[model samples]
Target: MLEEIAIEDLGVIRSARVPLSAGLTVITGETGAGKTMVLTGLGLLMGGKADPGGIRPGAERAVVEGRIDLTRHPEVVGRVDDAGGSVDDDGSVVVVRTVAAGRSRAHLGGRGVPQGVLAEVADELVTVHGQSDQLRLRTPAKQREALDRFAGSEHAEVLSAYRAAWTERAGLRAEIDDLTSRAAERAREAELLRLGLAEVERIDPQPGEDAELTALTSRLGNAEELRQAAQRAHDAVVGLDMETEGSAVHALEQARRSLEAVAEADPALGEQAGRLAEATYLVNDVATELSGYVADLQADPAALETAHQRLAELGTLTRSYGDTVDEVLRWASDAGLRLLDLDDGDDRVTAMRDRVVELDDRLAELATRVTAGRRAASDRLAEAVTAELSGLAMSGARLEVEVRGTEPGPSGADQVAFLLEPHPGAPARPLGKGASGGELSRVMLAVEVALATAGDEPVLPTFVFDEVDAGVGGRAAVEVGRRLAQLARRTQVVVVTHLAQVAAFADAHLVVTKATGGDDVTVTGVQQVAEDDRVRELARMLSGQEDSATARQHALELLESSAVGR
Candidate 1:
């Protein structure tokens, strides 16, 4: 329910603060007095589009604020609580919107919120019915939805069943389409797998063979250089002395003997001579080992060639894997597993085909069930809507619902249509062709009433009807007023109407009047009327004369009679 509306610098409403209450409240004014601006303010608070033109001339911005009560609306409360906001014990939710020439912003519970989020939350709180509501009856989808609500739980159950079935069918069909479209591609992939596997098999690569071959190649490639260096080193350490006619070991032996003869004369020289003799014996042993090394030093060319050929074979692996033999060997092991799977392609295809067949059968069965459920739901919906038309003063009118099977969609395969007949013996046609504006409004009202009954959210504690009485008066106007009051018992209702009959039913009456100060055109004030004032106001509405006693008496009787209706 809207608790209050505050408007600033918006058209004729320069600054208006209006307090609202529960039950039927009326706002009455002369033409151009800016009653529509009140509704416009509410629309802005509901996140409707804005225009800078709505801002008063010379004003930089316009601001509108709506304070609403949300006692029974826990969904909204939960959202606010999640965002670390608290609703007062009185359960009031404040929504404010401001429009500047440059931009607009929305505030919820004193926190800034995106306009789109504001709009979504507003939809949960209010449903505004205006002159355009009558035109909505012309749409087939709206009519079908109205009938479904009237049909109650049985129809809803059928719809649920139908939707479930339709979903399964749609999923199966989509999968089949995707798989069939890719069949040729899969076939090509299978052939490529076979060729790649065959090529890898022909290589017959051995793991770790590259490491052994690398070591052999190193030794063989430098064999000549290694042997020559070894021979030269041996000749330096133990080769024969050419001038002495004997090896180095024999010359050292003769020098040690001459020093031994002088050592007996000098004790220190004798010890040195003994050390030289031991060194000479050790040198002879080393020379004998050198001779054996020379005999084994020759290089083999055939062995070098063999090592080069093995290195070339290992090079083939480097191109496929990393630039090394270890990596290629690992790749071959992985490729073998892939080849095994490709070899079993026929078995895989058979399994996939069987699964597809099972899914297709399930989809067909579901489609049939969906079609049947939709038809039943359609019949029940038509019956309920036709019953409601009688109470809306369209006794002769008939409503028909046509439900037909369609291709599967996200919603289901049920396509619904609504048709109507305005008078007895008239053939039923689509709503747009059959009902006049007046009839359409009543039909829409009836539909709204029914749908509101079935709605899950608490009915807004207040309703504001803007000129819904257009093209209607007399008995029809009184009926509209009576219905508005009836809705008021469950929720507060505010209406702006030109008809006196409608005004007579308001629990509180407010008259909006304009005043002019200098060149300023302003909607100056709203006055709450008392009983005596209400009688005079109703009299003036009835005959434009508060002075007429007869008109006043008639107004009293109208009020009394309306009380009885209540």
Candidate 2:
């Protein structure tokens, strides 16, 4: 709901604050009093195209600021928050639009934002109907949305199911396309993997095998040198050659005997003799192991050749797959898993194809149900709106809602068009094709009133009608006012009208007056009137004179009649 609009330097409205309220608020004024400026200000707040030509002469800029209540619109609040804006403590937001030179700037909740952000937030909060404005249901998509909303929650559930299935089917089709397009590439990849796996399996490389082979090859290459060294050491330790005087074991025995002979003369000598005896035993053990080493030392050429052959084979496997046997084994393991997936490509595609078929069938069923629901809603909506048109002085006019089959999409497989028949014997035509401005306004009002009572909550919080009472008078004007009031019962409504009958039905009435200053400057101002003041304004709207007793009486009667109707 809009609480207030403060406009500055816009057209003839130099500076004016228009206070609005719930229910229907009507603005009435003379021909050149600048009543349209109120809606122009509103249009700026709604992110409509800014017109520099509309700016007041000698003024630097034009500004339009609005205070909107967001208590019932959490989605709009979220959008403002996302745009780095905040809501007021009273659950309201301030939107300001400033037009200067040739550019315009928009501010929301005290934060500067792009003009498009204002439009996005306003789309959810307000709906405007005017002479040249496009109807909300003008587009086929919007018509479909309105029909679906009228179709109720059960149909919405069916739509949700259809969308889910459609999304899944699209995904499966993409996967199938990818698999089909890449079939040859995958086949070649699989062949390469198979060849690599065969090579690895043939070699049967094990962890640490490369290091083991390296050690064996080193031992086999230097066997003769190792044997000679061991034989010379054995001769030195055990006196195996007589030319070696006093081997290590013989020398230790001589020392032990000398120490024992002296032990009887000195006790310290006995301890030394015990140490020599331990040394002689250690030397004898070493000499025995050395003799065994010399006996085992021999070079085998055949064994050496076999170790080289195995090492060469393992080296070949490492150079291609990895730097070592363990790394090669890891690579082979990963390749084996990849090969399995590549081998199953055909089977996987077939499975996904079958799933897509199932989804197609499911979507077709849901689309049919959705189309049926829309057709049913179209009939009821047409009947309700046509009845409203009769009350608005189009007794012979009828509304036709045609639901035609089209290609299936996320919405459905239907195209909904709202056609109008002006009177009897006239062909039904699309809205705006043949209808005059006044007829279109009345039709739009009827449609809105019908939609308000169509068992779905109103989509917007406020509805504004400019010149809705055009070309209407007498009981027909009264009916238009009543219908607007009816719509206001469910949402806030603001109308700019000239008809006294329409003005009488407003919950709040504002009169725009133009004043000429001593400097010869004409300025417009808005003032809310009530009681006798409102009656005088309505009288002025009824006739050209507010002081005429007859006009005042008629205005009073119109007010009374509207009250009773409400």
Candidate 3:
């Protein structure tokens, strides 16, 4: 609910503050007293379009501010926080808007915010109904929402479930399209993988095989030279099968034998003899290993050819998949995993097709239930609103809520609309098309009255009407006032009206009085009036003479009767 609103330097309102209450608050004044400026302030607070012409002459900027109680509206406060703003200490939000000649700015909860942020949050905070809203009532979507709201929780629940199922079905269909659209691409990719795998399998390359084969080929290509070198080294280490050659082992043995003969004469010669014997043993072992190496060396061309052929095969694999045999092996391993994933395409298509079918069935079931609930509620809403129209002095008017089945939407498969027949024997036509301006206004009022029954609905916290009472007077205007008061019981209501009967029903009445200062600047002031002041205001409203005894008495009677009637 809106607690207070302060507007400055906008239109003819140089400065004005309106303190609102729970029930209806009516703003009334003389013709040029700037009564509509209060609603203009509301428009700015709700993030409406700004105009430079609205700036008061010689004023630097025009500003509008509002304090709204969020005790019953935590979600709106949450939105404020989401926009990086904070609420007031009293837990109410402060929304302020300022307009300059060439620019405008908006603030929420004491922090600067984008106008769109205000637009988004204000949608949940207030619903403004005016002459234009009566025109908007003719739209089918609005009609559908109105009927659904009248259907209460049952319709909302069904609609919610239906939307969920519909969304699921849409997602499944998109997935199915994606999978089906890529059939040829998947086939091409799979075939390419198969050919690469076939080439890798034929070669049967191992990790490091390229390096191992290169070493083997190098050794085999020089086998002859390696054998000759091995034979020379063997001959040097041990005595070869040739004359005039003495091996190291033989020399060492002779030295040990000479030292042993001397050891009989000296102990020093005995230690020298032991060292020579150990050297002779080591030399003999080396000679035996060299002899075996020389005999085993073979310069064979066939083995060399096999090694070169294997190296070439590994080269093919390296060029195709990697720079080396080891990297090629890694590529093969990764490709194996990818091949498994690619092979599952057909299976995934089947699964998604099944899911789409399941969602379609569920969507149909939910849509059916939603349509049923909407139809049931449509009857009740039409009956109630039609009765309200009669009470609003459209005695012969009838409201028909038509709920027809259509393709499924987020809400449901039901397309709802309202038609009006102003009297008997007249063909029923859609709301704005059939009704006159006065009838349309009354119809909107009646719909609001009917909607008041939906207290449990999650709707806007406040409703503002800009001259919704236009073209309405007498008993009809009083009925409009009572209905607005009735509507306000569930939420805050502010109406701009010139009807004294409507003003009489307001829990709070504000009068906008404009005066020309010494500088010839027109300044408007808003004052909340009660008791005698309100009566005098009503007297002026009724007969344009506050001091007339007859008007005063009549105004007094209106206040008393309006209070009793409420």
Candidate 4:
């Protein structure tokens, strides 16, 4: 429910902060009072288009803000929590909107939000039924929805089941259509997959094969140079040299004998002679190994040519598939699987068809149950709506819910319409064509009452009625007030009217008044009247002046009667 509304620099409302209660909050004042401005402010806060012309003559901007308590609104609470916004200790949500020259902004829980978000949240919080509510009834879609609402929870359950079934059937039908439409494309894809798999298999590339080939190729290309280098190393380590007196071993042995001759002159020279003898022996063993390596080293041209051919094959695979042997091998593995699937297409399609049939059977069963449930609900709804219409002074009118089968839809397979008869012995027709403006209001009231009592959840938290009492007065106006008050007990309702009887029914009254200063004129102020003041205001509404004795007495009596009922 709305907790408060604050308006500033908006048309005739300069600065006004009006606190609201949870029931039927009424706004009334003189014919030209800024009452309409209050409703406009609400519309703006709900993301309605902002008019730069709505700003006061001397003001640069206009602002409208409202605070709502979500204590009973679990849906809104969950949304706020999901969005990371705060819900106050009392579970109240704050919504604010500001408009300047040509720009506008909205805020929720003090955090900035897009105007669309404000509109979404506002839609969950309120519903206004201004004088134009009668015309809205003329729409066929709305008429259908109203009928559904009156049908209660049974219809909702049926609708839910029907919609689920319809969705599954529709989705499968779409998939089949798509597949049927592209048979040629699928065949082309199958051919491509088969060709790719065969091509890759012909090469049969192995992991790491490319690296092995590269190493072999490098060795073969440098075979002559490698053989020459190996020969030189073998000779340097232990090969006998014809130019020298002897091999390294022989030279070391000659040096050892000389060192032994000098051993007696110094003890350190004796130890060095023994070390040289050991080195000469080790050199002879190494020379034998080097001779073996030199004998084995050779270059084979045929083997080098074979390695070159293998490298070229790998290069082709790299170009078409991957840069490395491992990547090419992986591609081969995946291609094999795709090839198998394409060859077995008929078997795969058969399996999908079997699964689809099973789903279809289950969906059909649910749809049958849904249709039965809707028929039952339609009967109950018609009864409730008819009961409410009697209280709205349409005692002779007949309210009916006409539910019939229709093509599958997101809602259900059932189409519901509301029919009405305005007078006794009159032929019943659709509500849109059978009811007049005043009669539409009465019918709307009946539908609202029936929907509220029948449904498990309320669709809207607030209802706005603009000139609902356009042609009603006396007892009829009082009845309208009574019905509004009853609705207020369940949800907030706001009405804009010039009738004093209607205004007198409000739990809280706000007056809009225009003021002129010097040569400038603007609707810049609003006042909330208290109990005694409200009586005076009502009297003024009744007789156009508070000083009228007859108006004051009647206003006092009205207040008393309203109090007694509460």
Candidate 5:
């Protein structure tokens, strides 16, 4: 429930606070006293579009703030929390909206949020009905929604399941159509994949084979040059003629002999002679290894040709698949998997078609259940709404909910319509054609009250009626007030009305009055009237004369009668 709304610098309401509570609260005022501004403030809090022109002259911004009690609406609290906002320990949240310079901003639970968040939260909190809603009630979609809401939660679950099944069936059918239409295309693609896979299998390239073969080919091509270089090094290390004393080995041996002879005179000389002997051994080992290398070196043209041919085959695989042998191998592995899937296309399509058929049967059963539920709900809804219409002074009017068969859809295979029978023996016609503006208002209210009473849970935490009694008056207006009080008994109701009878029934009555300053600047104020003040306000609303004794008496009588009705 909305605890209170504080509006500032909006239209003629420069600053005003409208207190609200858990029962019917009506705001009454004369024609230009800013009564609509109060609702405008509520609209802004509900995240409606903000009009910059509604801002007061000389004011930079317009602000509308509301304090809502969420103790009974934990779902709304969860929404606020999800938007990074927190509720008070008492289960209350403050929603604030500001409009300035053609832009709007919203804050919930003191946390700044997108305007859409405010809309989402507010949708669950309040349902606003006005003259426009009366016309909306004529729409088939709205009529169906009303019936569904009356159908309660169990029916809602069925509808949900049906919609899910419908979506799945639609997807399956689309896939089946695609597969059937592209049969030739898919066959051609599978053949191409088969050909490519066969080629890759025949070549059978291995990872790193291209690099390994390149190295072998280079070695074979330079075998003769390598052998010549190795021989020259070998001759230099030893000597072409081993008998000559010009080789490194002979020189080192001569040095070792001299150093050893002087070793007894100098111990350091002995260490140097040992190192020279080790160096001579290492040189001889290298000369032996070099001779072996020269003997092994051979230009095998046949092996070289075989290596070149294998490299060419690997290159062919790389050119079509990847930049290297390893990459080609990966492509082959992926293609093999794709080929398996392609091979199973017909089987997969047949399975999907079979599933679609199963889904069709399931959907038909659910749709039948849904249609049966709707028909049953529509009867109850029609009877209940008709009962409410009788209380709204349309005792002769009856509402009929018609369920007709239609193609299966997300909602179901039923097209629901609301028909109105103006009186006995009158043909039932669609609401738009049979009901007057005043009758539509009553019917819309009847539907709301019926919906509220149909379900275990209340329709919403709060309902705001913006002159739902626009064209209603006399005893009918009094009954409208009574019915509103009845609804308020179950949930909070706020009405912006000009009828004294309706305003008199409100547990809380607020009056909007316009005052002009010495400078001739006009402003409006909203004050909750009480006792004699309430009577006088009602009197003023009754005959445009608060001081008239007759109107006052009439207003007093209205209060007495409404009290008895309550």
Candidate 6:
């Protein structure tokens, strides 16, 4: 619901704050006092197209700000948050739109956002009905939407199922088309994969095999040097080709023997003798192991040549397939799976075709159910709207909700439209054919009331009527007022009206008055009026003179009647 609107340099409204609340709030003024500017300001808040030309003369920019309640609108809150804006803890959001030169900017909760974001959130937060909407209600598509909304969740359930089936069918058809069109391309892909797999199979790469081969080749290439080194170590440790006296083990053994001779006269000497024995055994063990290594090590030219040849072959595989053998092997594994799928494209296409047929049958069944539901709801909606029209002073009126079969879309296979006959012997025709502007207004109002009562609860948070009572007058105007007040019981209502009867039902009344400055600049302001001021405003609406005592008495009676209606 719109809590308040602050408009600056917009049209005749130089700077004005229009406070709104959760009830019927009406804006009224003389013909040129800028009543429509209030709705224009609201349009800006809702992210409507902004014309910089509408800015007040000599003003550099026009700004419109609105405070809206979001307690019943989490989706709107989520959208604002997604746009990097904050909603107040008390469930209110501030939206501001600024128009300067040839461009406009939108801000939500102190954060700049795209105007599109505000428009998207506005859909769930408010519904603005103007004279244009009365014409729109005659169109088949809009009437269908109204019927669906009035049908509530049951028709929605069937429509959802039908659309889901239709989407599945479309997906299957698209896949089939793609498969047929790209059959040759897919075959070429399969052939390429097959060739790559065959090369991989012949090479038979293994994980870490290249690294293992490299180590073996290095050892085989240096076989002679390795053997010479092992023999020299053996000679140093024991007495092979050289003397063991230069070896570390031999030196330690010599020291241990000297210590043992001295310790023989004491207990510590026995421990030193054991240490010399262990050192001699360790030196003998090392010499034996080195001698074995030298015996096993051989420089075989044939084996070395074979290792080099194998490395060259593996190198070819590595360069073409991967930097390493393991990566090449992984590629082969994934390619094999893809190759299987590519080879089975024909079978997959056939499966998809069969599934499409299945979904078509399902969608047809749901469409039939949807049509039935709409036909049943059409009768109920027409009856409710006709009953509402009777109270609006069109006593003999009848609303016919015509449901015709059409090609199925997301909404199902029905085209719904409203046809009205004002009285007996009148041919039932679409809106604007036989209905006047005032009749259209009443019809729309009746439909809104019927729609509101049709649902378990009101859906839109606020409803704005921009001169919807365009051609209505007298009791019909009073009925319009009563209906608006009735709607306000469910949600917030903002009306731009000229009728004192319609204005009488408003819980809050704002009158727009223009003040011309000495500099010849005309500025407009909106002020909430009460008691004597409200009576005067209503009197001005009833008659050209705001101070006429007869008009004031009539205004008083209208207010009294509106209170009694509540």
Reference-based TM-score, model 5: 0.72
Ranking by lDDT: 2, 5, 6, 3, 4, 1
lDDT of 4: 0.74
Q: How many clashes show up per model?
A: 0, 0, 0, 11, 0, 1
Best by lDDT: 2
**Local distance difference test, per candidate?**
0.69, 0.90, 0.83, 0.74, 0.88, 0.85
The parts of candidate 5 lying over 4 Å away from their true place are 1-8, 17-24, 44-53, 58-126, 133-138, 208-308, 424-427, 432-438, 458-462, 471-475, 489-492, 504-510, 517-519, 527-566
> Which segments of model 1 are wrong by more than 4 Å?
21-23, 71-92, 111-114, 132-139, 164-399, 424-429, 432-439, 452-464, 489-492, 507-510, 527-530, 546-548
lDDT of 2 by residue, 385-476 (tens): 99999989899999999999999987878999999999999999998779887888899899888878777574565888987878878999
> Lowest-scoring 10 consecutive residues by lDDT in candidate 3?
236-245
Ordering by TM-score: 6, 4, 2, 3, 5, 1
TM for candidate 2 is 0.74
* CA lDDT for candidate 5: 0.88
TM-score of predicted model 6? 0.82
Q: Write the number of the candidate with greater TM-score, choosing between 3 and 4.
A: 4
- Cα displacement (angstroms), candidate 6, residue 277, comes to 17
TM-score of each: 0.60, 0.74, 0.72, 0.75, 0.72, 0.82
* Residue 248 miss distance in model 2 (angstroms): 37
Candidate 3 stretches with Cα past 4 Å from truth are 110-114, 132-138, 186-341, 434-438, 455-457
- For model 4, how does the per-residue alpha-carbon lDDT over 146-250 read when each residue is reduced to its tens digit? 666655677666667666766776776676665667667777977876776676677777779889888877877886787677677656655556225645665
Error of 2 at 367 (Å): 2.0
* Lowest lDDT 10-residue stretch of candidate 4: 129-138
> Which is the leading candidate under TM-score?
6
